[model samples]
Target: MPQDCERTPVVRDNGRHQWEKDRARAPRTVRATTGATERDTGLHPPDLVFHAEYRELPAPCPLAEAFGVPAGTLLLERSYRTRYGPESAPFALVTSYLVRGMIAANPDLLDATNEPWPGGTQSQLHTVGIELDRVEERLTARAPTPAEARDLDLPSGAPVIQLRKTSYDIDDRVVNIADVTLPADRTELLFTTRLERW
Candidate 1:
């Protein structure tokens, strides 16, 4: 997050010419039904390829308003949509989402940490997640290849973001699950963290 870190246009918007068209280039293929499903047959992959449907989250849930964050923050939310085929049931396992807070910009945060490689902009909290040389907060326990952009569940396009997270299930006095880990191979799992910005 630099002092001038800027927003990039998403492929879906008109901002990127040919982007939307490129993303939707080919329709997913549907396999023809093998008479087996009609008979008392064994299981098989669906005749239709798996797909996801997104309905943008409504304005402010209780959890969001509690923070009193600003407007136009890019919010991430877990969807409960259903489907029958794919590499796996990718979305159901997610427990949280991310939304940009409505706060003024700050990029001087770049030089504060011990990260060896401070990527392009090291100012914003969310973008800071990727800029880190590696996880040092003890929270970033899982590591995956950069190419494993799985969370969006879309078939193509470079994900605008990537995240690695760990969760703590605190119940009363005992820590039942300390830093229970969750990685967004396809969809990011965004929970609140106590770390400072940048």
Candidate 2:
């Protein structure tokens, strides 16, 4: 139940690591900074395993509104589960949505076969000429649903953190939206802001 895991923003600068290319590679340890602090802990990307599933579906009214699209507009939904090991529960449940028309120019984006994408969502959007301007994450905690509790292997009374991440393009349009569910028992959220000297 200790908050032992750390999560941080993946900036464009950390060029795709080699582990992203070979999932079966031997475990390679990396350091992860603790929440809002400089303390580091060992983490292994190679030890984590994941699967992705993609589908095209009509955008629900709320989703359409978020994307500023017409109700029922086709959207690409990508779901992913990445666990510490083959037999472990997922670290987080992630679902991402993108407006189909916006990325249809790149047919590859519509296919799941091309996933485990080198640079992840930002890079995928780049293939269609979309440059990200900013990413906003809103976090909230609540009791997990029966399915979520089971999927995340939560102990009784343990809550889950629901994070809604909204990505905006350089033009200020919402380009992608993702909902991530993390087990509160092991997760830590960090936020840092730098202000220019007045």
TM-score of each: 0.21, 0.78
**Please, what are the lDDT tens digits per residue for candidate 1 over residues 1-198?**
221322211111111212212222223231123211111112343422233222234336443443234443344332222222333322222223333222114333222232111211112232333221222122342343343334333333333333223221122111011111232232233334457889
Off by over 4 Å in 2: 1-45
Q: Over the full model, what C-alpha lDDT does candidate 1 score relative to the true structure?
A: 0.27
TM-score of 2: 0.78
Global Cα RMSD, each model: 20.9, 7.4
All candidates' lDDT scores?
0.27, 0.70
- Tens-place lDDT per residue, model 2, 1-198, is 222444332221111212222221222232121110112113344655658899999999999999999999999999988665544577679999999999999999999887656446766777788877677778899999999998887778999999898889889999999998987877756555557999
| Residue 130 shift from truth in candidate 1, angstroms | 3.5
Where does the lowest 10-residue lDDT sum fall in candidate 1? 171-180
List the candidate 1 regions with Cα displacement exceeding 4 Å: 1-49, 57-61, 65-74, 78-96, 100-198
What residue pairs are clashing in model 2?
Answer: none
Among the numbered candidates, top lDDT falls to: 2
